[model samples]
Target: MLGFMDYVQKCFYRASKWDEDNSYANLNATARALLDFPTPKGLKMNLSSLSSPNFATSYSMASLGVVDGSVSYLYSSRPLDNALNSGDVQLKDAVSGYRDLREIMKPDDPRDWEIWKGGVRVDRRDTLLYGRMYLPASTLEALYLRRLAPTRQLKISAVSNSRLPNGGTILALLQQDNGKWSTEYLYSTDVALIGMRGLYNFGFDPRKALPRSTTATTTALDPRKIAGRFSAGAEVYYGILNKSGGMSTGFRYTTLPSNVGSPLTVTLTVNPLMGHFQASYAVKAGEGAVFCSRYDFNIYSYESDLVLGCELWRRKQGDDTAAAADASAAAASGMSAGNIDQTWQPETTSFSREGARDDVTGVLKARITQNYNIGLLWEGRYKQLLFSLGSNIDLKRREQPFRTVGIEIQYNS
Candidate 1:
């Protein structure tokens, strides 16, 4: 986990405080949360700027698209962060960016981390180039190019103006071996992907047959796609790697405000991940104001697992709210967006009035194997700052709960 975190900092050139000395422990505990899942619906923009003796830059990002129907890409100076500066020492006789085995395992060592990343994908093929330098310890990185060509496949498209379902099958030889423990698969076959909704990905290692790896994901699209109304879908995933695996399923619903005074837009996703559910709603509350709230729940316990976040955007002008509403409607309807003024963009122009979150989360997992089963997590975030409290509880016996706490502060700029 520490190695991964260090890689991320090196990749982004320490753009935020993600690599700060004190944040190490916190980053370790909440690594999973830091790797966020894509929101079921909507678009977001994030900007960060920094200037100091060591680094300086302005970064802007915008994300658009869906999981299966569209393309997603990022543009930034992240690829340049891992290079060594003029004054940095070039340690002699180092291996893989490390001077010794101890350096490779030490999370708090003050070593200059080097990382670089760049990638582009086209359909079934992808090309990636990356470099990393873990000064005084090891220098590690790789460049990879891969493609998935289905040797045999069949597809039946949905019939127009008919109730016919769509489906396809594929038999593909995969050689996505990057010399890594993961991504070292040799072949894949579609056990099933029927009705344009069901899915199955069966993978094989040249040496194993019971199937050492498999991934099954299914999504049932909303039967009806309508504006200003509920549109819902459910997704399920069952995956296995070697002997351990997990199963999870969830449903998502989206609603767009039908009228000027209705809510701006909202999405509620239940069970987005293990034992978790989330609801995010944003609205134009007044002429120049927008209010948004996000709430999340875990089936286990929430005093330490629940997260409630709220944001208020104070517009520069009274008409800003109306403009934002119009722009949103236009974008959603596939209308020409040229009429929308860039100045009216809420994420770009609105002044943040307030932003904070209340989070408490924990889980009580029941282990029911052929024989038996148990879990606890706590996290908090106020604006750009975060803290976590973790514990393990063994209810079967009266024992003291093992506990830990960590804090992290991140600045967009």
Candidate 2:
């Protein structure tokens, strides 16, 4: 017979679906990614190497008529935390043990394992450190992140530059997440700024027992099966040096989809002190394509702006190509391909399994602003190198339509 604690752990695991843990600050991440894709202003190159499972270093150079360069170093206690190179191979053996449990358990049956492997815990142990130094200017920047406990995290970042008012700036953040809610408290040396932000998820509670009703089971067993997630959050900040304070409230609604499909995200935010309001929407318009729009308004100034953007991905043809085409057809017909019958798998496992075949060959992104400024970017891979070429154009300017043009290339080994 399973122990009481074991039973509880099993129940929790069965009822929960693995999802990306994002903080309140990222409430509009999806829309931002689509609308605000960064474009290089000049020539930029990045070269990186993974010396070991937990260590990596990289060099970056940029030329905008004048040349400048930087070197960066990164260290991680866990291989999974290192983004220079995915640690999928290292994780394969670790996840194999859980396959047995998955096979034995029902869709709604809960199970437990080590926190690192997939179990829920109040504390986790992972640390990452990164540092970069710029040439000529001799500017330095560093970042630190540590998971103090399952529910707590500490993040610190600092920058040093001669042109800065204090020759540098440092910001420290303390974060807490308990599945249903997330909060962060931060302090910055610049202006002696202090702030707090929090987000609360509605309609779901992981700590509580799972509901036995069929309708509830559908939602509790898999996040993708749920209608959607609604979240409310707020942030308040004060600057000691400036002796000023401000607050903003926001609401977000998002859907959780399977690996084969893209999710939808919508966000609304208002800053009462500034009399500013903003709304954003992002969604998958079709297979390999995403659409985003944002609106900004200021009541006090009676000013408003609107922006529209879209991204299209090009992938190599393969066996799954037909399936993806079918998915696109389904989407066009007002159906979701993710609703198709498929075995439920952990998020990590799904990512690792589909990592290779899902590689995108190229991407095209374009956005237009209310001011008649248009930006276009094309990113693709060449051999082992990745590159982005972009340009900005001002339609209102007859003398010079092109505002900026640049190219960026990156390689990792």
Candidate 3:
């Protein structure tokens, strides 16, 4: 009976194949990340610490004298034995090595890489609970996420503030992902809104049986041979309180990442209810540079705007090859392997590149609009802290060219 049950489980896993699908909300994630990189305003500082493998806390203070803090707890069904069962240096080293290897073997997808280097890992099917509170205003925010199965997840997020109408808002979402498509249903307290969204990929489906031909098998194994993945999705929402309804449709095409060159992603979204259209194109210009542009248009108003942005990475010379060597040498020389984790501090203010390479010294991001508004941001590590400097200017405003300037500092342990 046990053997029969195990066979059934294996068959079910093979049939589901939930890993390939992407969330419907992420249809234009690549373009949004490149074009909407946040710029800090005024002075801000953040500090975070990991008390244990499952618990973490953070604190922040802004220039306006506002203070906020947060705590997060993670629960994994199958937690890493080495990370949870022991605090020994050897165990920590083993766990770190395993994580590094996993990252190295991760698929080279253009959409996976972010601007930050390292952070806590929350595996699939894990549960996370988080809460934050802000002083003075006494605003509270909370989030909960739980994976009920390999293919289904539930998420709840809420915010409460005295200044907000009806004491803020709450949202709940149910998400499901199959190998070829993804879907989501959501409810929001504001306006008693309910929505549904779905995405379908018109590419290869892993759940299908493999072909017998050698050439077909080889082509299937190499995703780069394919031109790109085309996906189409739509979302509709209805508000019970407001007695309103709206809908939008989106399409995306993204080329697979390749060693020879970077990939490209293009997306288009249309809102028939409002006669609004948005299109964006993003591409990695090279190993260290990326460029993106977005256009917004409203047919009824005959209004349009264009925005362009770029990001550049500064990496240390020979740091990529030397990083592993240096780590090995440090371990051989009796240095604590745990200290090695400190060398790759995660950036709190910007997206980080995802991979084994940790040689990035700084990042520069700039954006400009058709209206002559310009923004610049630079993020880098200073000793044990990460810092970001940003400024905005308007060419049209000759009297006040500098619109805003700010700096942010962060530390994690």
Query: Of the candidates numbered 1 and 2, which has the greater lDDT value?
Result: 2
Q: Please, what are the lDDT tens digits per residue for candidate 3 over residues 75-158?
A: 333222222111111111111000010001122232332334367544344565667777656788887766566567688999
Where model 3 places Cα greater than 4 Å from the true spot, the runs are 1-21, 65-125, 215-224, 258-261, 319-355
Q: Model 2 reaches what TM-score against the true structure?
A: 0.79
**Model 1 lDDT vs. the true structure?**
0.26
Candidate 2 backbone collisions, by pair: 10-110, 14-110, 122-150, 123-149, 123-150
Candidate 1 similarity to native, TM-score: 0.28
> Which number leads on TM-score?
2
Runs off by more than 4 Å, candidate 1: 1-226, 229-242, 256-305, 314-413
Query: Candidate 2, residues 75-179: lDDT per residue as tens digits?
Result: 766663223222222221211111111111121222232244355454335677788899978999998877665566788999999899899999999987776
Which portions of model 2 show Cα errors greater than 4 Å? 1-21, 81-124, 212-224, 258-262, 318-346, 349-355
Better of 2 and 3 by lDDT: 2
Q: Give the lowest summed-lDDT range of ten residues in model 1.
A: 94-103
Residues 242-293 of candidate 1: C-alpha lDDT, one tens digit per residue: 3322333322222322233444545455553466765655444443233344
